[model samples]
Target: MKMEDYTVEFCPWCCEEVVIHAVGITACPSCGKPLAPCSVCWDAHGGCREPCPYGCAGAEADEQKPVTTPPITQEEIDFVMANY
Candidate 1:
């Protein structure tokens, strides 16, 4: 089997995997992260062609997510105890 046939691309910024099958990509389709030109190789993932170690799962989920509630801080707890 050819290695080129099973090559995968990963986002350099978010470390998300790209699902599409293509080469010479300028940006990651998953996270829209700008891809850097590999200095040593011309393939989609340079010579390694391995999945990102960071393992983002899916960057698109992060991009489309909305802001959630903030966590309580120590200051808030201290203030409540002091006031009470």
Candidate 2:
């Protein structure tokens, strides 16, 4: 494949660098972990040419603020501990 047809990424599972092709499910040669695009890479490529096998199509939206619950009050924690 042409140089532009692939990307090099570090595989965290295998702790090694791997070559991921843009056209297919590129798995890590060492640990068999599928190399999928992250938000950074997805944005860099302006989106993949095909549907990603790992279903990371919405990864680009991760830049948005994460949904989080409000902090629990000390009274709430005390009530739970007392009941338990």
Candidate 3:
């Protein structure tokens, strides 16, 4: 069966077999294990954030925060101009 086909579940955190709904992907109702989408050494979005549809917290796995574009300020522009 495919991953999605896993209607039944084993919570990685609790590591016990669990009852899953038609499309559940988060906590195990029994043990409350936070399940997440597993990728190649990372979550698919390239951040520590849970990729699981249910957004289950996983193995302290993601250490990196998401990258963001810093806001540009007029002072920053002036500093760049002065330096350049």
Q: Pick the candidate with the highest TM-score.
A: 2
> TM-scores of all models?
0.29, 0.44, 0.32
lDDT of candidate 1 over 1-84, digit per residue (tens): 222322244555567643322223244444554443233234474453345322223455433333222322345434433443
Each model's RMSD to truth, in Å? 18.1, 18.6, 19.5
Cα lDDT for residue 63, model 3? Answer: 23
Where is model 1 more than 4 Å wrong at Cα?
1-6, 36-84
lDDT of 3 by residue, 1-84 (tens): 223322344455566654443343334445544443333224566765444444435446522222122332445434433443
- lDDT tens digits, residue span 1-84, model 2: 244445556666668755555444555555655555442346455765455445544444422322233332445434433443
**Candidate 1 clashing pairs, residues 3+ apart or interchain:** none
What range of 10 consecutive residues in model 1 has the weakest lDDT sum?
A: 63-72
Please give the CA lDDT of all the candidate structures: 0.38, 0.48, 0.40
lDDT (Cα) of model 3: 0.40
Candidate maximizing lDDT = 2
Q: Which rank order by TM-score, best down to worst?
A: 2, 3, 1
Of candidates 3 and 2, the better by TM-score:
2
